[model samples]
Target: MGENLHEIWLKDALVFLFAAGVLVPLMRRVGIPSVLGFLLAGLALGPFGMGALAERWPLLEHLTFADPVAAEPFAELGVLFLLFLLGTELSFEKLWSLRRMVFGAGGLQAMASVIAITAIVALVGAESHAALAIGLALALSSTAIVMQTLTEEKRAAGPVGRAALSVLLFQDMLVAPILILIGFLAQGQEANLFGALLEALVQGGVAVAVILLFGRFVLKDAFRMAARAGGRDFLMGLTLLVIVGGAVFTAAAGLSLALGAFLAGLLLGETEFKHQAEVDLEPFKGLLLGLFFMTVGIGLDLATIWSELGLVVAGLVMLLAVKAIIATVACRAFGVAAGHAIETAFLLAPASEFAFVVVTTATAVNVLDAPTATLVTGIAGLSMLLTPAMAHFGRRLAASVDKRAAGEAVAETFPDLRGHVVIAGFGRVGRTIARILDAEDADIVALERNPVIVARERKAGRKVYLGDASRPEILAQAGVAGASMFIVTVDDAKDAAAMVHAVRRMRSDLPVLARAQDAEHASLLYEAEAEFVIPDAVEAGLQLAGRALAEFGYSNEVLKDRIAVERSVEYQRAAAPPA
Candidate 1:
């Protein structure tokens, strides 16, 4: 039995890697989210179809090498890395800057959603404890799925995207306490509730103290030393160690590993190495996240779904509808435009991955039975599958709403255009480029589809247009043809490439400078014949090398030569035809 388990584990890893290699590219070609593909692959190899694998194997089920839990530490590691990355993206300063959105809007959404869902569950005849647990679980949106989709759609830095991220971040921070509350509520006994509550408060206090101390003093020096070591592999390893170590420490203190990871990331985010940390962790983050999603697929029991098909479908629809309506209401209350409010609600209507964690924990604590847990999990999974479709539906709904409110001509025109460089996005990379361009006396005609960003940018005295750049009419109205240079700074490589193609057709000789956020994007831009393809990673590497050389007392000429050699090599590699 041991040997069979080992063999199956190895086979599964290989199959997973192979499938990922194929599925990611195919999904990209089809304009589908890679999450959908990952889930589909799991369904294909899982009990639903081939039945070639089980959800768990004895030797492969450890949290760490020696731990006995069936869920590997890597599964937790995936969540840790995700939270870490999220933290890196958000700093305390930035969080404070957006306090109203982060706390006011985000807090209201969480509170309202939980209350609304709790009521619905109770109305459906669930026990109070079960109803509360379900409501809490449903209140949390999938930060992983929502953020990933927004990123893939090139909307992450947009107003709507930032607003979504802020809400998700608040929800993530809320998860730790919420989990503790569920545990207490599940116990039901007065003594147990009091004891649990006391323990939780103490644990939460300690965790906060540790994070504050680490962030204020220790992490900065530690990362500084690591940065000076100048070894890429070492840096990557150190990053994983911090994430895992933080998670372990948090778990030991009775907190969620995901929360620990997030806190660790938040601390690191305050340091200079934040961007580099994001770069170092990319490969591992992607692979583990993919594996985590695939594992989710593998764990799904098709037999159960087949037996409870109607219940499962009904649960999924009900969850989506309720969440969507609640979210839409919340967004409107926060003053989002009707169209954007609907889009925001739809984008977040699906149940989050965190729901699985909540439901599973509730079941373990006896607040929810196995059947209830399974039902919630299946519904959550189905909601994830429907997320992209819901986003599209919301957009259509928004457009319809807009058309009815104003004439088509008024609705079609993206207002307030002057001297603005018309950046189609405001993502990290896009915003960076925009800042640089803004510094160079260029007025930005920022055209962003995310309503939140559109509002924010408009307030900042920059003209922002709320419309898609790929639409020729949208582009024309943004003065793309007449603009200085059309900058394609969207996160989606395919979309960026398509926009470039469209721009070229419209203005044959226009200079289109694009942000190649990664090697894959750079290659795509090169193929698309973009005038200037800025490989963000390669540029960061060059900057690091230049600074290191200077610190080593190298002459200016020597440093220049070093940079030239690196550039020449990169250019040669970039220009080489794909294998």
Candidate 2:
């Protein structure tokens, strides 16, 4: 009987791994978010679909093996690692730079959502404690799903993306306090509120102190030693040790493990070893995180969902609508323009994985009952499922809003700015270049596909022509024939190469400078007869190397020589005939 059980467990594990391997790539090819794909896979194999697999497969079920209720530690670990990576990507300086958006917009959204939802819950006859818990849970927007979707869409560095990130960062920071509050509410003690608050503060203070002292001072050196040992397994083990140990410590102090993992990430993020840690942990993080999302799918009870379909749908709509309104209002309050405010709101109107963490924690501590927790989790998950569609609609809404505002302006003819640099795709790179050229007193005209960005640029005194660059008619409209240079800085490599080709064909003697995201892209631009092809990654590496050398006491002259030598070698290789 034991042997049969072991065989069943092994088969379940194999089926899960196999399904994930197939579905993720298939989803990518079909232009769906991989998270959605994982969820769909789970649902298909779950009781809702074929139901061939066990209602609760043993091996997969082991992920949620805690006593009181099943707790998927590994799946939770995925959330931890995802947060860690996000924290590592964000530096203190960057956070400080976007303080207004990160704090003002994010803070307003969080507070407003909490208050509004709490009020709604109270109106619906829930107790104050449960209402607060539900409100906090609903306040979160999934950083993992939203960010991943944005990244896949190649908009992770755009205006909407940055705004979404800012709001998510604030939510992450707020999760720590929310976790403590949930713990207090769980105790259900009638002690002084102030005393409970004081206890929470002391516990939080100790956790922070330990993380700062031990994490920064001790863990860095420990990891350095492990890295130097040249044992891959040892380094991997150590990475796990730090994550699990930090989480265990924080959990013991009555805080969320995800918060502890985030803190651990921040600590490592500050060290010289951050990139190495990122590279080493990436595989484990990706696989485990996918598994985590899959478990969320598996844990979803189809029977309950069927029985409460209308309630679930109604709850999902209400939750998303409330979040969107709150976020939109908050963005406006922060002085973001109307169109951008709407986009920002829609992009962040879904409940985050952190919501699940909060809800699960609240339920564990008796702040919420099982059905309520399930309802909240299911709604949150559904919200995440709808995010891609929400984002697409948001962009469309922003576009329509922008067009309505520009009703008269669209008919106005732009001045013929000749002998100036014509920039295609006024995105991050294009806008930056435009700013520099404007500073240098060089006349410039920017062509952007996104009308929202074009409008913003025009409002900022930039002469942006709203059009696609790949088309010859648009290029002609921008005076590309007479321009001194054509700068192709679009995110799409194929588009950049096409623009280069069109420009070269139109005017063989005209110079075209193209920005490529990598070496392969640079080669494509080069083949298109671009006068200059700047590979962003190569330039970034050069800059990093120069900074490192300078920090190590190298003189400017030495650093210049080192850079020149590296460039010369690269140039020679580029100039070499194809093998």
Candidate 3:
């Protein structure tokens, strides 16, 4: 029996791995988000899909998830890893910096969404408790889905991303109290609801404090020791240990496991080993998160949805509309820009995985009927599947709004900006160059894709515009034609090269300086007609060598000559035709 059980598990694992490793990539190549691809894969391979026909054709069993619920625990781990990875990207300081938004915007979004949803459900004739329960469940958005989409779009650090994350963070915090409230409702006035909620709040607070303090004080030292003692293998093990250990600790306190993992990520993000941890654990995060998305698809009972098609559609539409309006209002009230608020609203309007948990618990405790729970779960699952499409649409809409505003500003500001420096990307390298030019009283125009950076820089009186510099229109609008120099400091190799190509098409003789990832990228930029290309690897080596010579007290002239010779040799090698 044990051997057979292992075989069943292995079969399911094999199917999922194939989806993650093969099917997802194919979807990505054609412009589909991996999250949606995994969802479709799960739906097709699930019991409702091919599994329903498996008994008649026994061979089909090997390809389908005969027992989808068996994968739920692993799916939950996927959520933890997703949140943990997101946490690593965000430091405690950055999180702290957003405290006002986290609490203000996040809190308002959740409360308003719940109230609006609850009213809608109640008006549709659900009992007060059932309506409240449904409202609470759907009030939250899927952190896994939203964060994954933002990460894929490279917007996780932008204003819209930050706004959505703020709301999601508060939703995670509400998990404990919301579950407690459901239990109180289940007791039918036999228990004190306020007392129960307060107790839960206190317990959660204590648990969080302990985890944060321990992580703040000991996590860095522990990671450093692991690196010193065990190298990469040990560091990887330690990362898993920390993530799982933190998750378990929080789960023990009746809090969300993802919360603990997020805390662990925040703590470790502050340590110097952050980049290494990110590289080491990214594969695990991706595979597991894919599994989680697939399970969501599996849970989508197509038959049930079809049977209650009208009601399901109504519920899904109502849930999305109500939440979107409320979230948008909440964000705007907190001073988020109209574009960002709208994007965040759409991204978060979908119901979360917590809805399934809440509905299941409510049904089990008799607070909600099984039929209602099933319907709610179906709606939630369908909503999650729509997340990727909604996010994509929201991003495009937001970009359009931002670009329109940028266009108006350019018309007003760029008429006489001649001989200026047009810098692509307002990131570290671009900013440094802009500062040097500013110090010299030179005119400058900068273009960047990140809304948050544009907002911040614009507030600080910089001439930063929100648009991708790789596009010829954005380049032309930025006055690249009239500028004396064009600098490409965008991090993505493809984007940097595209900027060079775009500029060359417009002004072949423009002095274009670009930052490249390595020798090959430098060669590509040089071929793209960039007048100057600085490969990071080559520059770092030259700087290291220069420091060494300086430390040895070499004469200034000798050091300069040695650096010049090395730079010339490296540049020539980089520009040479590939062998």
- Which candidate wins on lDDT? 3
Count of backbone clashes, every candidate in sequence: 12, 4, 0
lDDT of each: 0.74, 0.76, 0.87
Q: Find the number of clashing residue pairs for candidate 1.
A: 12
Rank ordering of all candidates by TM-score, starting from the highest:
3, 2, 1
Off by over 4 Å in 2: 1-8, 47-71, 122-131, 151-162, 173-190, 335-344, 354-374, 395-418, 425-441, 447-485, 493-579
Q: What global local distance difference test value does model 3 have?
A: 0.87
1 versus 3: better TM-score goes to: 3
lDDT of 2 by residue, 1-579 (tens): 888766656655665677668867788798877777776666665544445343456544333211212225666777778767766776667657778988899999999999988898888888899999999998988776777667657777566777887888678667567876788787766646576557766886798689868875798898889889888777778877877777777776656676677677777888887887789888777777776766656656667766889988888888889999999988878767667778878979888777777888998888899988888888877777678788889989987775554443333434365688888888889988887887889988877766568768888888786666676766776777788889899868888889888888788988888888877777778888888878887788888999999999999999999998987666555434334
Best by TM-score: 3
lDDT of 1: 0.74
Give the higher-TM-score candidate: 2 or 3. 3
Residue range 1-579, candidate 3, lDDT tens digits: 998888888988899888888888998899888889999999989998888889899999888985677888888888888888889889877898888788998999899888988899999899999999999999999999999888877888778888888889988888888888888788887788888778778888888899899888888888889878966998988888999999888877778888899999988888898889888778888888898999999888899899999999999999988888888888988888777888999999999989998998888788899888989999999999999888877768877887776665555457346899998889889899988889899988988876667778999999988777777777777887788999999878887888898899999888999998889988888888888889999999999999999999999899999999999999998887556
Q: Mark the regions of model 3 whose C-alpha exceeds 4 Å error after superposition.
A: 217-238, 272-276, 411-414, 417-419, 466-488, 491-579
Scored against the true structure, residue 309 in model 3 reaches a CA lDDT of 97
- Listing every candidate in turn, what is its Cα RMSD in Å to the true structure after a full C-alpha superposition? 7.7, 7.2, 4.0
Any residue pairs clashing in model 2, and if so which?
63-72, 64-71, 141-352, 142-352
